[model samples]
Target: MKLKKLMTILLTTVITTAVLTGCGQQENAKDAQKKPLKVATNATFVPFEFKGDGDSDYKGYEVDMIRAVGRVMGRDIEFNNIPFSGIIPIIQSGDMDVAASGMTITKERAGKVLFAAPFYESKLVILTNKNSGIKSVEDLKNHSVAVQMGTTAADYAQNLGLKTKQFDHNAEALMELKIGGSDAVIADKPVADYYVATEGKGEDVVIPIPDSKKEYLAFAMNAKNKDLQKEINAAIAKLKETGEFQQIYKKWFNVDPGDLPKTAEETLQ
Candidate 1:
């Protein structure tokens, strides 16, 4: 009977240990799955990401889009404001997990980072005051142009030999044109249109730059994080497939986005 009692005590001890071990593993899995992601975005672009109309926190298309991506990623995201020029570097340094600042994905940039599927289709255009006497792209010559620093628009303006005035944000560049500090502002078509619609008060005009090519915008991650990039790509795909993305697109663009890139490679457009 003494031997039997000792055996029974040992069996109970082993069983309890097993149960506790299983519970600890389960808790660890939950903790691992609940880790939050950090995102970098420049919020000075209208209709994309911007300081709220009064809310302070971000309130724009990319803000809603990134949050949706986070939901599909099964992680909460903390959006941080980095300068547009610093976003890529921050991602490269692994300090940021994502970049979604109306960033245009190009071969040069894609070579440095892992790009998810494109979320927005865009083009560059010229923005000027309505009475600035600039009716066409050709008329922009010999005039100073304001541009958001480090943007394709600035590159385009410089390549064309225009006097370039670079600012850190689109709002500031547009303001330069508004106050007659610059002859015009070259920016993304949608951004120029958004400003004209919301605050231009019939004083601004958007003109297409002839021969401008289409540009695609996507969330970028550090090249080392392929798994995270896959997760982000899946999030974008799922959002588009379920029609949730369209609702958000229409909210800002006033029209359907139709479709976005289906895969990472397709985003190269």
Candidate 2:
């Protein structure tokens, strides 16, 4: 009897240890799968990412593209709608996994974040009240132009000898134009066009600046996230090849994308 009792105790101890070990491994697997990708972006840019009218849900081209990326990676995504100024810092500090707010891929930005392949080629344009008499960059010489603080538009206008009024967001600059505090506003062509079409300012504003100054937009990941950057580029290539990219482009802007080199006649005319 003593021998049998001793054997039974040892068997129970071994079984309990095995069960605990299996439970721990199961918990570890669950923990590993719980980590979802987090993408940060400035949600104020329309036709890219913005609060859907009459709802809290986000709606825009960038939002759709990122969703497609999540499907490709087989991972869930969480969007952090931060300000443009905070996006780079958040990603650098490891607070976000990706940044994709129609961010421009410029030399200055490349130094801060790893950029994916160019997603959209954009042009900068100036917007002014139709009655403001500002028909071009040349006309901006004597007028007060408003741009969002810390924007490329602000920097470009300031360097070009225009009197600049800076605000925290493009909406604020547009407000300045509406209130007659500023004579004009400079911004990307898409945002300017969105404001004109959706903000009840179609006849009030016009794109005064031309396409001579164009910029390419891209996604940004932390410099350390080479894997994520590769995944994004691959997905973008797939999107382009399937004509989904062109469809999204036309859905937002009525024009066919003109990124490829234009003929001399097209360029001149």
Candidate 3:
């Protein structure tokens, strides 16, 4: 009778243990499936990422492209709005999984983060009020130029020994130009063009510098996330081949993406 009782107790204990283990495994699987891909972006740049008027949601070319990438990787994407200067550090700290805010790939940036394939080619342009008479890079000499802080445009302006007014956003820099606080605003060509069109700055001019080098924009992540980088690279290649990339480009820029390099490394060559 004692043996029968002992057997029954052992059976019940074994069944309970097995059920608990199964439940734990199922919960772990669900947690893995629910993990989101956190993407960090600065939403001040239009055509790249920005908040629309009267809208709480962020939208732009980069936002759309990253969403497509998330779909390709079978992950839910969550965007976190962060300052441009802090985006890299946040990714390095593992607080964010990706940074895709029209970030231009540079040697300094490459050392800190792993960049995916190039998604867009851009150039700096000088934007000035029509009557400002700033027609070229040389004209910026002795003029108070406005640029977004931590951007290549600001670096270029400082390198040229020009007096510069730094703003957190490109829109503020352009507004400084309009208000006569700055003689000119130097920024990405697409951003300048977008501002001019939307702000009713019909008199503004976009002056492309002849010697300015092209900047290749790409998504960046922590160096340790090589697997994620590879997946993103594959997604970008697939998007390009499937015509989805060109469609997004046309939707944002109103023109075909003509002969742009397939990867950031390709631009180096």
Candidate 4:
């Protein structure tokens, strides 16, 4: 009888262990699926995503917007500061899940990654010293222009047959313009305007690029992240509906939020 009772107890203990092990495995799977998203940004673009003063985290339009999206999705955002050039490649490799680098949506980039809703309206412009006399895109023909590598501005300059100097960051490219290493700096309209309004005041001038088409900027992710793209787009739409999107826009830009493009395609009806 003693032997039989001992055998029964051992069998019960084995069964209980197996059941608990299965439950633990299932819980681990759930936890893995809920892992925080890794967001990559080059914290060099002011009013977009730049490091704040005194041990503060990144503060800018993109940073705020990403945080808002994470809140609406009930997901946590894990920020990784990286160079703007590597933003896309890392997304493709699954090293990062989102790009918050204030990236302009281009047809070529659209082919490589999925874009969320367009957030900011932008265009290219020329930034130069007031004494440089570069008032138009045509004026850049014979001048050495500085541009941030991996940006549409660089491609635009190259395509326009201008002598171009590429820098890893737009700030450096702008500095090159200030130091006379380049005759002019070509950058996104908003960034140039920000510099002109703040640090570049009195000494710098922004020339509207003639025939420059309107550009849209947005968040991008791996092409395979369609579900996440939908969630983000939905979150942005909600933010717009709640008027939070415009609030954020006004906070950084001090301007009314205009209607955002529904898609990146320039010809959208």
Candidate 5:
């Protein structure tokens, strides 16, 4: 009777161990499947996803690129539109998976987040009123230049020895410029061009900066997310090769896409 009882207890212990191990494995699998990536961005910037012309839907360049990336990766990209300054902090705190707000892959930003290769390039332009007589950066030396806060354009404007009036968004700064509250505005070329072409107030603006101040934009992910960055790089390579990237560029900028390096193209190879 003692031997039989001992045997039954041993058998039960073995079964319990196996059951616990199996449950752990199943739970791990489920966790892996549920890890959908969240991409953070500042959607207020136009031609790169913003609240549409009074509509609720998002529109513009980054919107199309994010959706294309989702399709290529077989995953959904959830865009969290936060303040520009909040993007890096949120990513650092593990609140977001990636950021793609036409972000310039600068050395400072690169140190904070893993940046993918350059996917888009935009010129840095200065905008001044038609009657301001500010035709160049030099013209704004002592004048107050309005720029979007916490942006590279703002940094550049400061570096040029201009007095800066920083606003949270480019639209606000541009508005100030139009109302004669600022001497000039510094921003990306596409945005300046868009405003000049569409907004009545922007009609008086002139692009004072040349093409040499162009900036390259890339996607950013947490430093720990090497795998996600690799996947994104692969997707960029695929899009570049299949000509889809060029099409999107044309759609947004009305220009053919620039050339990518052989290494960037061969990343997935």
Candidate 6:
């Protein structure tokens, strides 16, 4: 009887260990199935993407929006800070899955990548120190202008025949404006406002250039990723219906998003 009791205890311990090991393996298998969705961004645009103090992680409106979108799709998110100019090429090469760095939707870009629904509306603005005489796009004709490279503002400035200096980051361009390296900084309105507010340069001026063309911001993915684009579109619509998108906008801009497009195609029209 003593021998039989000892044998039974040993058998119980072996079975328990096997069951626990099997359960752990199943959990790890589940974790392994979750593929990460890689996103590329430029972290210099405040209120859109920027790094926090002492940390390399990016934090901003676009970061939060993409994470939320990932949760809805049941995918893990990985964000990479790539140069804004190279974001599309990175997506095209499959090194990254998506680009969400406050990219404007243009016919040219749309031809290269599939754009998700427009998340925000933006326009070009000129930021100058109070003493700078630059007030409009017309005023920039003879002055040295600074713009972030690979951005619509840069293109706009160049097309205007102005002598332009392109910088890697909008902050650097704004700094050039502050130090008189450039007569004016042409950038997205939101970024210009963010710089002015944070730098305590309230005395600086912002001049909005009226264009019949309205620019909308959206996420970009490779042209071949149609299924992923559909998923993203549905996710955006759900977020809008649930008011989650509005909450995100309000958190970042402190104002309502107003009327947003119901679908990605609507933004183009």
C-alpha TM-scores of all predictions: 0.88, 0.79, 0.87, 0.87, 0.84, 0.85
The residue-by-residue lDDT of candidate 1 on 1-269, one tens digit each, is 99999999999999999999999999997896578778899989998999965777888898899999999878897989878989899999998888989989888888899888887899999888878899877888878899999888988888888888999878889889888899999999999999999888998889998788988888889998898888887888788889889999999999989666666577664
Range of the 10 consecutive residues with the lowest summed lDDT in candidate 2: 260-269
lDDT of 1 at 260: 64
Report clash pairs, candidate 6. Answer: none
Evaluate residue 59 in candidate 5 and report its C-alpha lDDT on the 0 to 100 scale: 74
Give the alpha carbon lDDT tens digit for every residue of 1-269 in model 2.
99999999999999999999999999997775456779897777777887865878877877877877676666787888876778888989988988878776666777788877765667888877777787789988998989877667877888888899987656678888888898888888788888888874455675646544667777788988787778777877777678776677777777776663221112212
For model 1, give the 10-residue run with minimal summed lDDT.
260-269
- For each candidate in the order shown, give its overall lDDT on alpha carbons: 0.87, 0.76, 0.87, 0.87, 0.77, 0.85
Per-residue alpha-carbon lDDT of candidate 3 for residues 1-269, written as tens digits (9 for 90 to 100): 99999999999999999999999999997786567889999888887998988988889999999999888878888989877878888989988999988889888888888989888889999988888878789988968999998889999999999999998776688789888899888899999889889883588888898988999899999989898888899998888889998999899999998876666567666
TM-score of 5: 0.84
lDDT of candidate 6 over 21-78, digit per residue (tens): 9999999966854788889999888889999669878898998899888888788899
State model 6's lDDT: 0.85
Weakest 10 consecutive residues of candidate 3 by summed lDDT: 260-269
Stretches > 4 Å off in candidate 3: 1-34
TM-score of 4: 0.87
Q: Indicate the residue-level lDDT of 198 in model 3.
A: 84
lDDT accuracy of residue 94 in candidate 1: 91
For model 5, how does the per-residue alpha-carbon lDDT over 18-94 read when each residue is reduced to its tens digit?
99999999999768645666888877777676776678666788778877776787777777878787888888887
After superposition, which runs of candidate 2 have C-alpha atoms over 4 Å from their true positions? 1-34, 208-211, 258-269
